[model samples]
Target: MIFAAILAGGVGNRMGEVDKPKQFLTLGDKPILIQTVEKFYLNSRIDEVIVLCHKYWLNHTKDLIEDYIPNAENIVVVEGGELRNDTIMNAVKYIEDNHELSEDDIIITHDSVRPFVTHRIIMENIEKTQEVGACDTVIPATDTIVVCHDGNIISDIPNRNYMYQGQTPQSFKILKLKECFNKLSDEDKRSLSDAAKIFVLNGEEVAIVKGEVFNIKITYPYDLKVANTIIDDAKLNISDAETGEYKVNLYDFGEE
Candidate 1:
């Protein structure tokens, strides 16, 4: 059984004045968290989705899920811990305490702010992870990168050939990620971004699935505008079926 854990328990500091965290903020009509959750909820491959949110937002989130995504199954809203890792730890604890999850039970641990993730991206990531060990979408650097020192001259421009910007829908096999998480040191535990990083630090081969540019994380207030435009563009480009139902798989374009 495939499962997804969305880490939606953040109080946005960067997105000042938008105090309720970026996930709860409105992107036009739909909440950013709802949009993020719906992408995976609509997918047949995802069996259950456990939303990790702050203790304060837990009940509200549950109500929002009911109102927004009525068709989803096994949707659980749990109170997250103070720290990010602590929040994830709570999710891990829940999985261990409840379900008999297998190594192949795919866990797509995603950020709640990145509402631009498409159905194709989810399908592609899961498919690739099934083939290889683990995979994540990363973008190559476009501008010059610098290695800086403490207010002094440091190394000159280095090779951009291998540099990449890591994006989300960062997926893993539940058992593998659990094993990696178990081995993390306190220092590494505090510094890690996603499950992929934990695997990399353990010398495991983590594959890359190229991410689309529109799948941007909403941090600042300006990001919402970009996401709105992307959603609008997506609707415009995609067409309806013969029965007048909108084809959700835009990436399945012309694929016989």
Candidate 2:
């Protein structure tokens, strides 16, 4: 089974002075988290989706599902942990405790705020995970990377050709990731910021699948603005077929 885990536990501290988490913020006509869920829900290859959300917003998350996603039963909403990695582990524990996950089964972890994830990217994650034990989505870095040890001075400048900006739907085989998780000490687990790093810390090879520039994570205020622009542009390109279908449905009467 291929499962999708969306981590929405963060309070969006970087986004600053928000009443709600960044995932709950509006994107296009729907909530940002719902838009992210829709990508996985619409994908033919995904078997199930579990959203790990903040405790205070879990009820709101459920309400969003009731409103937006028609097949809401396919999604599972659960309380998330305080930390990002802890939220991921919560999903892993749920899967282990409830489901019969196999070594061949894949689990893809994504950010709930990354609403622009494509079906192709999701499929690529699954494909890469099948070949290797784990895979991380990444785009080639276009900017010069300055390694700074202090607040003011740059210690080193790395080659841009070697740097890749990581993105999500970072995927891994269920059993393999579980084994890696088991090897981690409590201190090691707390330090983890990325799911793919679990494999790296375990001395395993994590494969990379090419990701697009548009697969940006909506973290700060600037990111949200960029996402809104993307959404507006996409809305402008809505096909005539869809508009025609809407018109056809609009005129339909109730069954006699």
Candidate 3:
């Protein structure tokens, strides 16, 4: 059985929303986090989904179920911590505390604001990671990349040849994840963006899985506009098909 841990712990400081976190922010009508969870639940490979939400927003997240965003049966809602790594660690503890998951049971770690994650991506993540230790999704960088410093040209233009932009829906074997997280040190607690980074730092190599371009993360206000355009285009495409099924164009919109 595969269990999903949808990481909804971000405060979205970059977007600067004082009212609520970006995950709880409304995109059209549904909450961003709810849309993310729905993607996992819709996939047949996913058996259960556990949401790591902020404690203050617990009641609000619960209300979403009545509106058909999250399925309450296979869903397990838990409180999140301040830091992203803290939240992830807490969620892991929640799993370890209550039940003992076997080695074969895979766990997918994904962000909440990234609601555009597709069923195909979800399936591929599981497929790539189930056999090998772990798998991460990334898209090739579109523009020429460079590293800069203090308005000064610190580094020259980087060859975008093999560089790719990294994103979430990173999946790991339950046993491997448990092994990695189990051995995390104090410095590991300090450095925390990618889950696979911990393993990589400890000398474990990870496999890369190609990701869809439309699977974007909603960070700033403009991103919402882009997402709106993508959503509308998908709506029109499905409407034109004449079939009842809604088939969305994955990664057709903006330049990645």
| Winner by lDDT | 2
lDDT of each: 0.79, 0.85, 0.77
Candidate 1 stretches with Cα past 4 Å from truth are 236-256
**What would the per-residue lDDT of candidate 2 be over residues 9-30, giving only the tens digit for each residue?**
8888899888988999998788
After superposition, candidate 3 runs with Cα above 4 Å error: 69-71, 149-151, 243-256
What are the per-residue Cα lDDT tens digits for candidate 1 across 1-256?
A: 6777788998888888855778998885799999888877878898878899988888889999999988556788988887766776677778878888776777777888987776777787898778766788888988778887765887677889978888887777777777887898889988987668888988877888777777789998788878777666555556444346755534332222
Question: Model 1 residue 41 lDDT?
Answer: 81
Better of 1 and 3 by TM-score: 3
Tens digit of per-residue lDDT, candidate 3, span 108-218: 889887888876677788988877778888999999888887678657677899788988888888777767877888788578678878678667767787787788999
Residue pairs with backbone overlap in model 3: 214-251
Tell me which of candidates 1 and 2 scores higher on lDDT: 2
| Number of clashing pairs per prediction, in order | 0, 0, 1
Q: Which candidate achieves the best TM-score against the true structure?
A: 2
> Model 3 — which ten-residue stretch has the worst lDDT?
247-256
